[model samples]
Target: MGNIICSHSLSPLSHSTARCHYLVPTSAYDVFINHRGKDTKQFLASSLYDNLQNRGFRVFLDKSSLRVGQYVPEAITCAIRRAAVHIVILSPNYAESEWCLDELYLLIQTGAPIVPVFWKVRPSEDRMEDENGVYAKDFRKHKKAGKFSTETLEKWRNALRWVSLVEGFISEG
Candidate 1:
C-alpha cells in the first residue's frame, strides 16, 4: 500500500486518560493490528507499526495507542470498529491467548477487511485439530479448565478456520 494522507488530526484527549480525539474522522485508523504480544511485540508488530506510521498511515497498535491504566477491552473494541482494515498476525501460540481469540472473533464479526500474516506457522497448522497440534492442545486445556463456554470455543475455532481460508502472507521466520 502507498502512503495515505489523512486530513484529520488525531490528538490525545488527556495525558492522564487513554482516550484520543479525532477531527471529523470517518474512521480513527487506516489499520488496526492484532497480534500476540509475547510472540511479536518485540519485533514484527512494533516494526510494522513504525513502518506503517512512517508511510503516513494511521495505525492503531495496542502497545503504542493504548495508555497506562486504560480499560483494555473497550480500547481494543473501539479501535477495531473504527479501523478501515485489520492485520492479524497469527503466531504459533496465537490461539493460546483467550484475548487473542476474542479479538479474532470480534474482528470477524465486524466484517471488515482482514489481512492475516502467518508467522512461523501455516494456515493448515492453525486449523489442525489433532492431539499434537499446538492450537488443539491449548484449546483442550481451555476446555478442561472451563475457562470459556463451549459455544464461545466453537466460535473461536470457526474464526480460526475462516481466517485460515483468507489469502494472506506466510512467514517462515
Candidate 2:
C-alpha cells in the first residue's frame, strides 16, 4: 500500500492506528438534506441530493418516508443527530420557514462541519441584516473572517459513502 501522509504531520503513518490520530477525512459526513418539503421543486432542481445518492451515499430525505403529522420533528431531529454533513438549501422561502431556521440553528450550534448549498440566493451581507438571515450571517462569519476555506467539491461526493443506506428518489409506498 502507498504511504498515507497524515495531514497533521509530514511523517507518514506506518500503522493504521497512527492514521486515526489526526482529524478524520471530511468524508465522514453522512449527508442530511435540510430543505422545506414545500420546496421540493428547488431541491430537485439542484439535483444535489440525487447526485449524492448516485455517488453511493446514504441520504436521509423526508420524501421517502410516509410520515404523518406530529412525529415529523422528532424524526427530523433524529436524522440531524445521525448526520455527518448538513446541506442547507437556502432560498427566500427557506429563510421564512421556522422549521428550516430551527434546523439551521441546531446544525450550527452542534459544531457539525456544514456545507451550505446556496439555492436561488446569493451569499451577501444585506441578506443577513435580520436574524432571519442567521444562516447567511454564519456563512459570512466563516468566509470573511477566514475561518472557513473553500473546501474541495470532491469532499461532498466522498461524504455520501458514510450513509447507512440510500433510498431511490421515488419510493413505492
Candidate 2 clash pair list:
57-160
Error of 2 at 63 (Å): 1.2
| Tens-place lDDT digits, model 2, residues 42-89 | 445237667888899877676653145524555555565557877766
Evaluate all candidate structures by whole-model CA lDDT and list the values in order.
Answer: 0.77, 0.47
TM-scores for all predictions: 0.84, 0.52
Error of 2 at 86 (Å): 0.7
Which of the numbered candidates is closest to the native, going by highest TM-score?
1
TM-score of 1: 0.84
RMSD of each: 8.9, 14.3
lDDT comparing candidate 2 with the true structure: 0.47
Off by over 4 Å in 1: 1-26
lDDT of candidate 2 at residue 101, scale 0 to 100: 49
lDDT of 1: 0.77
lDDT of 1 by residue, 53-99 (tens): 99999999988998787666666766776789999999988988877
